[model samples]
Target: MSLDGHTAVPPESSIPPMPGFPPRAGIPTQHAAPPGGTPGFDVTGWVSAKRHRTPPAIFSLGPEPRPSDPKTLADDAIPGWKLILRAALNFLVALEIFMWLTGGALVWALGFVWPALIKAAGQEEFWATTLLNLLYVPVALILVFVFGRMGRWKAVWRRYGSPAWSRLRGVAVPTAGPVRGPVEPVDVWGPLRVVADPGTLALLDAETAQGLVGDVDHQRLLGALERVRQEPERLAALLGAVREHGAVACAHPSGARDLPGRSLAHDLLSRQLRLGAAENVPKNPAGYRGADIALDPLLLGTSLLAVGPAGSGKTTRLTRPVAEALCLQALTGSAVVVVVGAADADLGPAAWYDVVVAPGDPQAGYGLDLFGGAAHADEAAARLADALLPDELALRTESARLALQQIVGPFESGYGRLPGVRELVLLLRGEEQAWAGLLAAVRGSGMLDRHQHELAQRERMHGLADDPGTLLADRLALLDRPVFAGCFNPSAGDRAPLPLFALRALDHPLRVRIALPDHSHPEAARILARLAVGQFLHAAASRADRSLFAGLVVDDASAAVDTHAVRGLQRLRAANAGAVLGLRTLVDLPESLRAPLFGAVGGRMAFPGLAPWDGKLFEEAWGTVWVDERDVTRSLDTSGGVVRRSFRGMRALLEGERAQTESVTTRKVERRRWSASDLAQVLPRGHAVVSLTSVDGTQVPPLLVRLP
Candidate 1:
């Protein structure tokens, strides 16, 4: 079977018989009839022939035993002979008691009077009896001590005499003989062993192992050797297993239908390996031969790189996997999906997604129009009121006085009529008298004309002002709706106001995705990405238990992230937040961003592209084993349509050769296509590869789904 165009090698047919072992003589070889058995020939001679069997054994009798002399028996007494004598004496005492009981008359009399005797004796007699009982206690204790010592001696003798016990103790003591000289204490410690051996250890110690373990290095080396010896096969098997499983595909687009089956095999292998399963060796399923793509779920736990030239289905693949995640989130009620693009028009409304806020054209000033209108009106109203109120009174004293009366009357009617207006009139009359007296000194000065000119200008300003009622109406209108402010030119001087309108509007948990095309711009992308991240953080902080966001998707994420920002996302991952970031090519990313971004991402998907750098980046990001330079060169040489030869003392020569044809080659190049079945098995469209690192630490393979 073949997977991803790689053929599987078949199993060996027959294992060769072991060498150097000859067939035993007289061992008859039996063969079955070919297909059908013919009439059997009589084989009475073969049946009657002596079979190879061992002869039966016959029992033999030995010489009779000799009688032991009494003197010899006494000298070589059995162990615990003294204890046996004591037991015999105790038994005789028990027999005496039984004999007395059987005699009947005396025993019956003792039983009848014993309790009455104690009662008759009274308190003083009882005390004397207790004293006598205490005397007997010491004697009984002495006897118990003597017996315990005897039992210990008997146990020691029994243990030494038992052959099985001697084997366990690793000593063979003679059962019957004059005692040998005192036994030396056995050294119970087993043979000392070292893995690298003493010579190798000394060499290593002289070289690399100098600082490894310091003074106790020898002990450490021994311990390590013990561990290695205990499980040498396990370590070897682990290394061999991962090597056989090979590279795992983390993610690949569903549109590349040719890749999923191969990708799935890789994914399965990776998962099995991660679980420490020895049986996860790669095997091509019979039906899946010729698979074009292979995926490994373990690879998804790392980062993924999707690479292709423009219009080569890179974005299509990236988005497809993301869409599938959204669908899954919807199904599980785990997340809400939001699609943010360069413009609102870029994302057509779909049922699975919600457009919280759409990106607008920065050049059109729509943001300013929406947010700045009310501010402008308020400023103008205040300016007009400041200029007109005082001047209107001076220019038309009578009209102004009448208007003031109307204003004051309304307040008076609302409250009680106030004496303040009357006092004000009296003060103005007194001021007039004082002004008349100073008129001669002020007559030739320009101050009076300047006041008159200012008064006249103010009168015109007041004439242009809207009624106070109208001013309130306009302010009320401006305050009615929320406003969205677009990006402002930060370079504009202090005169330019900060974007308070947008900031205030964002206070509510509204969605705002900023697309920063010029990531290279001084701080544009950083600012936007920061703002987006801030919103998430703010929402998370404000909510009681997190889970405040619908969802945030960052497309063309390369522009929005830097090293520091990626680190921030890594921290956010602990908060159960979901994010999807799309990149054009993983190799093109700045190292600062690449390291942290890859470290943070829980899943990845890749699309096919023609770039050696892409393969290198993928290998690094996914932790794929690097192909040996020699092996790569050999493969490439075979790949080229030329045969090279070298003769002794002659220059190498090349001969033209045709390339081997493939099933799906176009113009002598392989064509990549993903089918519907492949998509069904993995990620869907608009979502290239759907790799997910589940909460339990399992990496789910990239699901290929077609985007609607």
Candidate 2:
């Protein structure tokens, strides 16, 4: 099957423009807001396209506004029919009044002049009647303008004319002067010519294009173009494959356009993926409501924290679209994305990813390297220990890591490679012969301390009840089950083993999906998730190239979140990397980590049905914004003679409100952007409250969003 789960055709017959994958019904396709219009408003969509510009291509983001178009004005101040009705009503009223004022005089004058006009013209009544009918047209028009609101046409056109026309055209049209020229072509190199479409070409500067073509490191250049299309992000790999196979030519396996997956919007030009629409709520900025709520690397680079109860659409609404966008960006040669979730989670189709690491599944395409492909045994041990040790064993973690290092280091030194899970577990168990063999190997390899004191110390610890090696062995044995026999064994199987360490030196965009076996092995899955997180952090920080955006999306990050992962998240922004972590609630984590995790991520989202405590984290993270506070006071009017008071009481009884003095006060004061209660209870189903911070320091205050 193709990357998008479509049936894959043979390479020879795959080059065809296929129909778009039919999306599930009732899910609205997202479109860019017509220039000068709100997100959901598109006059062009409502009108005839034949009279305007051509319909946009499937991947195009429709048209943008021109210089002459009114930027702040939207189309049609009033409905066209309503405007006409108003104008016609005014004309009829004016005509009735005119007749009323003229009364019998107008009729008398016309009757008196009828014969005189006929005699002067020397024509029949029919001819005279025709002449009068012709004169009425201009007179009626004059009356309509004088009395009717028909003059509003000028003002309406003045405000909405340019935008309405531009939206209809699908391209900006100049109000004055000759039409704009066609987009210039970029002169680039031969290799890049294969995939550069006209629109993509137009975006390229000649000098930059030339520079990129001449770049000695084609792989590096490919990485730089991630998120922006030049050629398929896999061009370098394709070239290498062709050279290795000595093939004369190769056709695109998946055709020009990416195979369709589930997504509401993919606006590559703006680098934003629309998730939903910002609801028109009081908490949201007036301008933001009805505008597309989207995600891009800029906002995602600071990391995103999503909290929602089960079935709140965290997976369906947020993770799916975000992962799809990153996958599409990866296709453009612009970004690398790693998506983690339960095996059955509908993150995306396996065909969309470069590697699908489904642990516990025998047929999984890739095996996860337990050591994260680390060359240093100590580095591998630290990462593995983090995954193996539970939060309750925080104090035991250091000793466990040390215990793992002792075994892993000696095994690597003796065998010249990292040990698989079973091998590490066997060493950790301190079996008589296994321990003796490892000690002999270490001594033979000269890895032992002078006088063999280190080996002696290890021996002494292994016989004690408090030895951390036993605990470490028990934890590592979780994955040694028959179900995971071939998994995490990079050197044992013919299957490809994916290592997070390779992410640091990537030349082209790589998409990886790690499906944790959540059902059958929940604990093991969490360990794997923690392993992935720890390695991803190390790789992102050590990356040699920062041009391509690196992203991770964890569909359920409950037990996977720990202190180390939180710290890693805080550093992702500076590394040009980010993560999207979804959680059921803050209570899933340790109470102490909740506030710190909130502080670590720059973006936070609270979905409908969130717990109050989870909502509180979002509330604190968003802080407060200034709003106008209004106060009104009413005092009874009771100062007069007895008869006056009785008269006021009678008036109050009749009016339903007592006569009173009123005082009003308005002041600016601080208020939480979104109170905890609002986030928990007031949020509507299929909606979420989200706040975002871009890498460049732009902040989008918390706003309620209606999911697409």
Candidate 3:
């Protein structure tokens, strides 16, 4: 419950259960311990409380923890005078009780009760003296016990007087455990039973129920329930279809849960992946202050570029969560996710992906398609050139593209296929035997006559001293080493290489993970990363079917953000696709491409320990917002009395400042959303400053967020 007198409803509990399907006996339910403890604890009750259970919702982290809002010092404050007064009052009350029980009893006994006792007894003086003395000691002792520091009277007096200790203590009370119920398994089928026919629900068994609960998306389940409620007749057939096939019948290609383990938290019904919580700062937008910082493909489709240094929580916090969300979305048949990272990077469990392209791993199960499955020679040439050309040689990108096209076009035309990495390198070197064989083959096929003009241009460029082919060949040779033998070969005869363009052809969700050869071939690894990114951008843009949300997650995009890749990133939102590019620093990219890369992506994240220079890019990209500025000034009190003025003059003469003067002024001013220094120095560990833009163009200003 909130302070507004209305209950703060949980998202899942907001949906009204129609009817039917009471919780089964073995269905798990969690319970939370009641708040606070007595002076003496209930050891048995506390220990017996359920400590752990299954998660309540499939997408949530067990339950929301208690908000640790700091308590105000004023709430528990007691004035020094009140403290003294309360102690004095308790002493007085205890003395009064002691006096009444001892002295007052003596008087009462003498006046009434003792008169009758004296008449009945013989020695009145002795009896009265002994009884009165005994009463004094016993009464004083009893009163002392009752009014002691840890006694009931002390607590009662404190509650009754100026320093009410119990009420003050209540302000900072701690709970024994979370104030929630047992973790009930997410009731996926309960809603279905209510809307659908009883016989339809009867078709579901324990296996199917568990499958639906774990694998099927909650939103898809709700949509199905809504459809069945509207047309009751459809329930039977729908249930019957899935009963034999299980929950995967409605899921994407592979209906089973892909990841062996989950680390980050999620809430899939709203299609939002929890990243962190926005900080409560005045500069933050009204609705976003202290809110859950989350994003879906809609926000990501605009593309997200995260800049941070190593160990800045970029991979563990941002990249992993986004990849996991997309993978989960893939299970629902709504998205295609491709994660590219170093071999050792923990993006997710390998089992989560259908294809794992480990280039140099001897035990690798799959290989990469260098051409991105491009059928056209020109398309493959452009993608390859973007990948191989270094940022220094970016000026010759066009020449390199055309240069590769000249070789790749003729080879494919003559040999009926594109050249592999080793073969392409040999051809790019302009070896006599390689060119002569190709020329003869093209002539035999009559390609030489049809493409004579293109071949003539290729020969003329090949003879130049500064030909782009030499630069491309040097870069291409990096991948043709013995370490990468049979890596880029499509016809390796053992495993079929997965292509980037495969995303376009899939109706169901597809997950692909490409692990680069980072250790043995560091430079080659960067080239591979860049190649995969460039190919992904082209393949995503050219997709004939854009129904599935296409997402690319690059754990370390050190060499991927070229001018062409940046331009391609800008157009992804319209294609219903997105890319998450993580970089250790902006220096990993060309200085010229930095600003353009920031501008291309709609979502920008600056993680902790960011360099001041890198933060400036984010600062400039985020721009400024209107804020209230305060100014304070102080001046001498010249209009006061003679004594006050003399004291002020003396103080001013001694200290070189006026003692009694003050002023404050406030006005609206424009300030940077996050200053470079603040982003560099003030950002906390496991936190980042992010600005988001949704697919529909809903903009969220840069705000500090504490990563979950």
Winning model by lDDT: 3
| Candidates sorted by TM-score, best first | 3, 2, 1
Sum up the clashes in candidate 2: 6
After superposing candidate 2, which stretches have Cα over 4 Å from the reference? Answer: 1-257, 262-264, 373-375, 450-453, 490-507, 632-664
**How big is the positional error of residue 385 in model 1, measured in Å on the Cα after superposition?**
39
**Highest-scoring model, TM-score:** 3
- What is the lDDT of every predicted structure here? 0.31, 0.64, 0.66
RMSD of 2: 12.1
lDDT of 1 by residue, 366-459 (tens): 1211111112322222222222222212234234333333222222232232212122222223234422422322343433443344233322
| Candidate 3 segments whose C-alpha is farther than 4 A from its true place | 1-198, 205-212, 215-240, 373-375, 490-508, 632-663
**Candidate 3 backbone overlaps, count:** 5
TM-scores, one per candidate: 0.29, 0.67, 0.68
Error of 3 at 150 (Å): 26
